[model samples]
Target: MTDTIFSARQRLSANMRWMRFIVLALAVFFLYSLAQDGFSGRDNVESMTDHLIVLFFCCLHIVFYIVFDRSKVLEFDAGFLYVKSKNGEEKVALSSIHIIRLSSIRLGYIRLWELVYLDEMNNSKSVSFQPLDRQVFSRFQEMVKIANPVVQINRFRFL
Candidate 1:
């Protein structure tokens, strides 16, 4: 059997749970403050509105990360690509992948990179992580080209 050629590990899964907890706690605290203070004056209403906006963005941020957080490890061998996570591991034949999309999103100071592909059964699977190396995508693209010349690799960035 051929040795493992490339491996990409999950970046945010390790600390994402804590992040969610902290953000939720802050949301609860802000809501509590707004309720206790009571909306009476114009200044108070403005302050409460600001808090509400912040809370809205906080919830959206957590949801975005959670939705994209799926795989724990992605490994490539000579003929197959393996995706491992809490549920289990899936082995995908190289030729079975038709489209590979790589996208990066920036939120404030944090940036996340995601890899999405269609499986053999035409199911879309995504793995979100910040690659340790900037060249990881290039290297991965090169490997995919060797395995399946027809594979479509798309890369884009978002804010």
Candidate 2:
């Protein structure tokens, strides 16, 4: 098997990190401001509504970050696949992959691709990224065919 490194688009990844950080900081600042007000009744309904809206957005960002933005490295080499994430690193054999799903997800204003697959242990794992190399899909199809011909592949776009 050829040694290939498939990484997330660096610019998009960095932007995502920055956005998450800013949202979290804003949430903290909002909380501090609310505390200074002694949690009083909504004397100013408009101001209270605006604060709630910001808090709602901050919560959504945290949920998405935990569920999707985890993968760090995706490397396929020597018939094995290496996935490194914030949680940990897992090495899986290509033959163990049964199904592959490629889909797009829209987060706020940006659209990113998600790669999901089922492993031998029957666990569904996914990585959200935009390929730095355009040949990534072709290389993946070629490798999957050679390693496991019966692997089911599906592609979809969510607009």
Candidate 3:
């Protein structure tokens, strides 16, 4: 029963983010050009600074994104959920799951899945995931039910 896999990854609104960055960079560049000083050498310096600023921000955004999202590799196998990330890897037996919740929506998919369960330490732990596809999303729900039929699963239906 270990069929869960990621069909997609990365942000669904990835295009939108790049679009915003492009627009912002263009606007900043135009402003810098308008404020160019009398000395040609100074003007060149201003332009270079503007370019550097844009590159700095764009690289910063990418770096932050990689650092945050690169941590987690999620999988499901034999009624257990495996989470391998920068922090650490932990497995959760489906039978131990007490709650399943899907929160937020984007492009016809769930943005977040919250699972609350007791881990091997018997301490309540909650894990949240951004499911990659509808099939994976539905399959996880079905798995939870198969593992513990009485478990509470709260799903959303949009008209």
Candidate 2 lowest-lDDT run of ten = 6-15
- In Å, residue 15's CA in model 1 sits off its true spot by 7.9
Candidate 1 minimal-lDDT segment of 10 residues:
8-17
Q: Estimate each model's TM-score.
A: 0.57, 0.64, 0.52
Model 1: lDDT to the true structure:
0.59
What does candidate 2 score on TM?
A: 0.64
Ordered from best to worst TM-score, the candidate numbers read 2, 1, 3
Stretches of candidate 3 off by over 4 Å are 1-71, 104-110, 157-159
Candidate 1, residues 2-90, lDDT tens digits: the string is 23334443222222434546656665676666565555444666776776776686677566546444326566555666666668887
Question: lDDT, candidate 2, residue 30?
Answer: 59
lDDT of 3 at 79: 65
- In order, the Cα lDDT scores of the candidates are 0.59, 0.59, 0.61
Candidate 2 local accuracy as lDDT?
A: 0.59
Clashes of each: 0, 0, 1
Which candidate would rank higher by lDDT, 1 or 3? Answer: 3
